[model samples]
Target: MTKKTVPVKPHRRSTPSPTPRPNPNKPKPGPKTVPVKPHRRKPPK
Candidate 1:
């Protein structure tokens, strides 16, 4: 009886793409303000 040998495949490595940068010429949005709730006081014992 004769034995057959199998060949091994090479592994591949992937590189990540660069991130996009924001444009400085564009105007920024205004800040938003939230309403504050009224403070409650405890009754005197």
Candidate 2:
């Protein structure tokens, strides 16, 4: 999550990585998506 002070900073570019990536790197199930079970695609790690 560290990106060269401001180089790799997310900026206003885009935050469209929450769903596709599955965000397993966070070690915790982000938000309520884990219990909701709306994603029949990736199915967690």
Error of 1 at 28 (Å): 0.8
> Which residue window of length 10 is worst by lDDT in model 1?
32-41
Q: Which parts of model 2 are misplaced by more than 4 Å? A: 1-10, 18-45
Candidate 2: the clashing residue pairs are: none
lDDT tens per residue, model 2, 1-45: 775565565659665655666565767655866554566667667
lDDT of each: 0.60, 0.62
Off by over 4 Å in 1: 1-21, 32-45
> On residues 1-45, what C-alpha lDDT tens digit does candidate 1 reach at each position?
787686865566455556654876776755744445556545579
How many angstroms is residue 6 displaced in model 2 relative to the true structure, after the best TM-score fit? 16
TM-scores vs. true structure, each candidate? 0.21, 0.14
